[model samples]
Target: MTNEQANCDTMVADPVVGDGCRRYVLPRQRPGDSTGDAPRVAELKCKVAELESQLRDLRRTNDTLKMHVAKALGLQLDSPIPGAGFETTRGGKAANAVAVSRRTAPGAVRGVETQVPKPTETPTGVEFRVLGPVEAAVAGRRIDLGAPKQRAVLALLVSQVGQPVSVDVLLEELWDGSPPPSAITSLHAYVANLRRALEPNRAPRKPASVLRTRGRAYLLDSRMVQVDVHRFGDRAMAGWQALDRGDPQRALREFDAGLALWRGQAYAEVADTTHVAPEVVRLEELRLWAIEGRCATLIAMGAHEIAVSELAAFTQAHPLREYGCELFSLALYRAGRQADALAMLRAHQKRMAEELGIDPSPALQHLEREILHQAPSLG
Candidate 1:
């Protein structure tokens, strides 16, 4: 068999990632070749399209079934209890009623299928966004979060949603460990105002739902609220997992979706407080990792020129970061700028040694060697 036929045969059988060692290029079709690979690839493409359509349909059907199940389970909650003046409405109260029945009248829902989502499940009610400013939106409508201190409190709880925050911790964060005689009272007042803003429709004298009290501590319930920080984390993790699985296309898609959630600096209203500072820095670092991963996946998918354009500003923004330098060098090498790639690495090495008094990392040094030889594995 000719070389073109061998290339065509390999391209048809191997995935685009191809064992993570080499690029998988489809050869041009030759005249009068009996291999018939042109039509074979088209046939495989058609099959893939058909399978993808079927998968989408399956997902839609599954979603429809889940909705039907939710409706069926909620039907019992919608009915008024005997001699009890519960409103026959469909909302938080209905969901609460299910919990009540399970606890008080266990036998009633003993055999019933429960669909009450756990606290970790993302809710459709209130979404707290700390990726940008501390903001809350209830069903697409943004609410007024009272004062700066109150927003800082929310930001602290949002950074650690579903966990209890002690009153002492709250006071320290709010007042910087210098509490006035009226400090506790003022904190109570702030929490009251926050509850009013967040759960405006919460009935009077009923325990505060969204932001709840636990002895001397308070917690923002994840079950009742959705957070963009959590969403970004999930998407970023998924993207990394996809990249590890040699699916750069899916990785890029996930990274794009995740990074789009960031509007500005994390916890912008309360950037460097005692409680919020660590989380703010950690989130920013995660954002950087996701961005770097995105560029790596782009280069892995043979879009090295696009990666080069992206990493140019990233390297400028974070020149001392060895991983970013390594990625930029690899992207340059893959984009066919072999000389430029070596120069970029050497420049980074100089900056490291001059400014930080340290040599480049072993990985970066190895990458410089790889680019010098135009290693086939750079692809």
Candidate 2:
């Protein structure tokens, strides 16, 4: 057939024939068209189905092997053995029985089903909000974490994040240096309760145990959960290093997010109650550093007006900090309020001299001279 006839046939024909008229004709396709990978695609899909079947078999075998190993070692496995489905009875007679379901498909692997039965429920990812009351994510929902005491325990663990919290240390913090006779049992109960609350469905069959007791201490598996305070500190430390490395843009991004994590005081209600005073001090210091880092980044970015308000608040909170005072003064001076900046420096210097019996640091003095446009001695 001619090219025009072929084109007319393609446009109007319901089912076109190939050039030889022996095979059905198909539509044109590009090199990267999804249909272009038909053979490889089919092969991959078959391979995936095969691998999935193999995986299901391996999981069943592993489950059995785990049980055997647990029995041999006198250790308990974290999951239940595969078994029959649950059956409910009425009037001493089993009726409307629900058969245990398993997913089966063609080419299924031997000694393994295509899909093993899953529990009716499973543990959802745990949510931790140190920005506010420590809350948990259970079953894809948020639940009230616990009472003040429990929250304090959670906070202690969260504050340390990945580090192990010792039993003695926890007892001391929980009881204010004097623990009860059954504190150990109480701690165990608390951990169990937390696990159950965090994973209600899995609690009975297989518990979600993030708190592990080893030797004399308990470790909270921070990797499996999110903690806002830990995230803040980690980002702030990285931001500080970024600043040292002369990457102010990235540093600003990090410090901004880190400082924003502070909804209120670090550990707010539990700070004083838990012997987390040292941690409180550390976070407070980091908070200041984060704020300073932000101001420095802003100044480096040439955002004088934006840094003014933050610097003002920071200087008020930390009048003795020479760097903060200097930054505030420079921000004000750069914003064309030289007179106000000079007054601020003098007021802070006077306060420092009176309160700490020391004058402002040389850095502050040098900044003041620079602000006043005065020439300092070269030698």
Candidate 3:
């Protein structure tokens, strides 16, 4: 065979061929060689082509699923996923997008003067506060959310705002898998009471606008209500992105706005409850991360004293957190308290050895060495 033909045959066997298409080259036929293998080679090539097609289809499906999972987990992707704007029902069908109504301007009256509206009136719609003890306000009025169990139900719905939650899942969460005989009936009553409380003006038998009913499930329309948790997440993500882009001032503002939404321990009222506990923990961690981001921004802005004071209380609250220790020590060192910085790391080392039977992390140990030698980079 010619050199070019030999090279082609070698390239065909390689798996890393570009454009995701496999090139199959049949071996060159010799004189008096049997032609019987030609059909078999062609068949093998067909099978390879079929397999490649299937692989491409699978990759496409995987990418689509990844986008969906990211969206479900509250991540913003650079490219929008198909059908993301629509909510999916329990029956695996996409529901129609909720329509947002636009207000029309009033007609002009030629002979009458128009009075400006007062700013004291609170805007309509439900406002949810889940950063602390769960609270809901509708049209500026506090809602009587009923007993603990009922509130727990609302909390679950609020956590997954705009997503349909199955009745079975709600039952499992509410009763911890040991529901009573009347659990379904009780749940219905609670939902009815919540509907009445949230929509006092809805006529009997009319469809709900805020809390919607899907097949075997319920969904809280996010557009009809405002959730502080979602707002905080958006701001926190923005802060993180700003910090990554080297805009510490904007990062600080975003982090402060997000952190200020927290009134106290997140979901403190329902934290003891089984189902909401995970969500509470997740939100609390996010809150701490925001605080850390804010402190990092302050340090970047040369406000090391503020970071030292803030991180002092933060490290005390979370002594075992290595990032907290690193930031705190760095802040002290930058604030001209080198001795305090070294002392903090020594204390951390001792505490870790005594409490957890482990040595300090590599980052902490490196910081300790840096402080000992008065590293110029510590500045």
Candidate 4:
């Protein structure tokens, strides 16, 4: 019952310190009792260094994987990685494609894709460059479209330049049938990237709108840029309608304008895709049809001399088209060359019979008959 025993007996059990107080409590050490802490600190330091080494190795592996993906996909080495929301261009407006990586910091929302902000430039004029190689330029520069798939997306959209191309249609064209889970989201990113690149400068308070989000699809506004196919189709349709209405002079003008849009194959750089091939063929056929229409219109306008030479060359190039041969015959007959016209029709007739095992249509045969005789209407 000395002073120490008296102090212990006087202490009551507090609620904070239950019956097992000594197990949870730490003993206060004396000034010279610092023996164990240094080894514990050393162990912690070793653990940290080990973890850092593992992290470095993991980062290297990640970088290597990124390089491999980029290479396999034909992506530019300098392209913004996935989840690195960057801007690109389409029809002179800004676009944002999904970045491959958004792990700006460790454990920082990794693998979460997001739409990139649109570019902040006002387009002065959207230049539609569909004549050759099918490129788009804005601010006097060609916009960077990340990789082939993304480029293909732009190409498809541009070909449908002024219309809403549905997301499903785009997927079909982009991947045939094997689209990834992130396809739609990635498409949005590509569109955004294209917009940003098209409008790089932050101006006009709102970006120039070239692409619009329609119901479950994207619409590229034609007024936002010039499209060669649109121009060609418009003029060619006008020309054909004029010809149907018997306005030869107007038809000639329209056909001339439509024909002038043909710098080369439509969207030539995109020609390798199976999806684009049919469209290219269609455009080619349209061109041939317009040529024939032009020749017919020219003949109707009494430009027989010029039409004869041009139609003859065209028929030589496109031997299988019976209408072209027919037009050539008519043009020649009108130009006081009845014998040459009959000979040309007979040659086409033989070629068709031998190649396709088919005879000339009745209209062509009747026209041939007219050329054979000294028909006064040849004038």
Residue 284 in model 1: shift from native, Å? 1.2
Task: Please provide, for model 4 over 1-379, each residue's C-alpha lDDT reduced to its tens digit, 9 standing for 90 to 100.
Answer: 6753443332221111112111112223336544576753454455456545644544454466457644442233442222211111111121421111001111111232211121224354555556556667775677676777776777777766556788888887676778889888888888777777665663654744776778898766665665566567667767766754556677778989888877777777676566567667656766786787787767766677998889878987899877688778877876888889889989988998999999875446646755675433344
TM-score of every prediction relative to native: 0.67, 0.59, 0.63, 0.56
Runs with alpha carbons beyond 4 Å of true place in candidate 2: 1-124, 138-140, 180-185, 201-208, 241-250, 374-379
**Candidate 4, residue 7: how far the Cα is off, in Å:** 99
* The 10-residue segment with the lowest total lDDT in model 2: 100-109
Q: To one decimal, what is the Cα RMSD in angstroms of model 1 from the true structure?
A: 18.2
Compose the digit string of candidate 3's lDDT tens values, residues 1-379: 7753453343222122222122223345456544565654665576567646644654474357546534334334443222111111111121431111010001100111112121222234788888987889888799999998888788888767778888998898888889999999999998998999888888999998888999999988766888788678767767766754456678888989998999987776657666567667667766776787677667666678999999999999999976678778878887899999999999999999999999875446646776787644454
Tell me the tens digit of each residue's lDDT in model 1 across 1-379: 7775454444332112222111223444456755656766665566566545644544454345435533432322332111100011111222321100000011022132223223454444788888888899887799898878888888888876788899999898888889888989988998899888888788899888889998999998778888887678667767766765556678789989999999999999778777777777767766887888787667666677898999999999999967678778877876789999999999999999899999875446646765676544454
* TM-score, predicted candidate 1 vs. hidden true structure: 0.67
lDDT string for model 2 (218-277, tens) is: 766655665665567567666755654445577788888887877777776567754566
Please list the residue runs of candidate 4 whose C-alpha ends up more than 4 Å from where it truly belongs after superposition.
1-124, 137-150, 162-190, 201-208, 213-218, 222-225, 244-247, 272-274
Q: By TM-score, how accurate is candidate 4?
A: 0.56
Worst window of 10 by summed lDDT in candidate 4: 98-107
Better of 1 and 2 by TM-score: 1
Q: Which candidate number has the best TM-score?
A: 1
